[model samples]
Target: MVKDLVCTLKSARKREICCSRTTRAIIIDEPTPGLKSIFHIIILDQRSGKAEVQYQHDYVGISTCIGFNANPVINFSGVFGTNAFALGTDVAFDTASGNLAKYNAGLSFSTADLIAFLTLNDKFDTLIASYYHTVSPLTSIVVGAELTHSFSTNENTLTIGTQHALDPLTVVKARVNNFGKASALIQHEWRPKSLFTISAEVDTRAIEKSAKVGLALALKS
Candidate 1:
């Protein structure tokens, strides 16, 4: 099978030319027995002086993730210098009968002020936990929550979701959150490596800037 390659060019809203960025990603599957990985790299304009690299790997029981950022390329001080390193990992366990449990945590911090930041923000890290229980051959329930806290901000969210298989090729998911948010997703697979998905989210409490709708199509060869 041939994997798809993707490239994207992005820029900031304020200075499009100075901060222009090009990002490339390559994904490989089954290069070896039970191993797959993705390599990603991004480059800011040669004139702008910035770069980053990220790698992701997955295997039978666990996956590893880590990345680094170099903004301004030269400055080694303050928040920009302190927050240059990004690291995290996620792990999941599956039972023979299709039950699943997962845990993930990650943090971004400055290399220079690691000790100071770690001491003060021990409780202000990002954490996620989830569990899925198979109710029937065609249905399952999932419950998950995420907490993010740092000097800059804090957020806590809880989610409950359900998946139902309507038929061999059609599946649907409905979810709700403690923050008065609700969403639904429908997926249909037409054939091998071809998928269609429709998703929408609405804020019941009508919070500002809290609604989203999306449609996506995927084709693989």
Candidate 2:
């Protein structure tokens, strides 16, 4: 795929102008052999002041294949916190993201199970975080005081939007809800590392007033 090929180069599939020294990429909705709904992303150097290309994956999208029963009825008859969706097996994504908020744009599962599971349970990552059209961000996903977030129960719902309140934590379990659209149950994911060193160093003075703008451009589509 073009994203894959672009990721292989110094340039990230995010598609950026030449004036900057940073590049980012994301692994779109392709369930590679051993991979689940994962987005392989790399930041030239945003979080850490050092010049390094950090790679990560988060399970935000996935749908059942023809053979598998999408979103199997998860008889949460087990425990309160137990995930209602069987979520097939945990498939690895290139990145991992979550928060313990009440609702969240959830894992890549099936629409049926997602709603059913939500009815059976509560305490999800802030239900319906954001909506999006594509997986691989053509540009960035971040905004001022707001950062772009992507979520999916599966292919049924893949969204990209900005969230005012941001929490950087991993969500353990969630109960699918019926009120909103259904999504895929994302399994585990694996982040593909770059063979070369992905590095960056953004100076406050260089970005100045545009630092926040640059961040917004760097994360949101």
Candidate 3:
């Protein structure tokens, strides 16, 4: 399910802004069988600060894999919106430790999903840079790439190829236009179906003025 709404920030230091947060809850339907169901609750919130539940159901029947004759696995991926965003800053924090980012000396924390705030100039304008790609709902894969935009038009097809990996569509994130000036190109790498990433050198202020780099939440039943 996809829905959009407007949210006014009490302390918005930026104008062109984007942010996202994804949450999940899960439960096991049965645990003693060759195959059983695993239930999941998924939430997707967008730049507007509005959230929607996309799936509320059991994933494919589960089967244990081991000498014990059974194994369990859980999977979910949700993709929405643009990643090449403008930022006042993407206030990064170590959710596990509850420490907020200072945006200096490099943000050394990393995770599976994140929503970032970007800014250009001193206009208090924040660009929301998001990142996501499509893969099978339950299977895991390792994708890698370092490529370029390579083409353009009123509409452009963003592309990347693995420097060593063996997949063509290794990374996925659309080229997002910030303030009608330039597009921020983001590269991606997905591993084992649980980790999603985008990495590049970027100037939050120059996101709308020029090109830069940087770094999803998803669910399914």
Candidate 4:
């Protein structure tokens, strides 16, 4: 459970306060046996000029979520089965318009060594699939593709990527897509929870073009 409260001044004399609360209840314990269920609820005050309530539940092999907002929009999503094999759908409806704002569905399968997903999106006009595999303890690879069809155009894309850990503190990653663009990055943890990274990208098809480079550093306290 969590709660947040904020105070703000609307003017020289007017003041406003907003509160938000979140609660979680375990309906069934994991150790209790056959089926386990959990419920979560969230309430938001008028501080944001909107009152909202959200609820989520996970029971047996099914997970469900629902949200209601001040905009009069309702969002719902559910997934069935475990991570090893599951199917899910997400959709949003606008009460004002009485129409579906968005909808998508996906299926996923996972194992100790690999995981894969297939999804239909954009009202079923687009399809995407991805695969990931643990090549070794220190290396892994991923591949993904997307296809979209519309009244005027059809688009397709594919990408492949891999990551390898050089040591406990250093790692490197590289990826390339069918669009002739390639990128690689290396990151090293210089100190506890601190890291430095360098990355570069180039257009394989047009070598004459200038390459892009980037550097980043993060420090944690």
The Cα local distance difference test for each model comes to 0.52, 0.26, 0.30, 0.66
The lDDT, on a scale of 0 to 1, for candidate 4 is 0.66
- Candidate 2 per-residue C-alpha lDDT over 39-124 given as tens digits, one digit per residue, 9 for 90 to 100: 32233433443222222223233321111132222111111122333331222221123332221223222332122222211333
lDDT of 1 by residue, 79-127 (tens): 2122354444343333333432344444354433121112122332544
**lDDT per residue, candidate 4, 11-92, as tens digits?**
3332333433433232333434444444433444445433333333342233333334545666677777675888888787
| RMSD (Å) per prediction | 17.3, 22.2, 22.2, 9.2
Estimate the TM-score for candidate 3: 0.17
After TM-score superposition, the amount by which residue 138's alpha carbon in candidate 3 deviates from its true location, in angstroms, is 19
TM-score of 2: 0.17
Best by TM-score: 4
Q: What range of 10 consecutive residues in model 4 has the weakest lDDT sum?
A: 51-60
Candidate 1: stretches off by over 4 Å: 1-124, 138-155, 207-211
Q: How many residue pairs clash in model 4?
A: 0
How far residue 144's Cα lies from its native spot in candidate 3, in Å, is 23
How well does candidate 2 score on lDDT at residue 6?
Answer: 27
RMSD value for candidate 3: 22.2
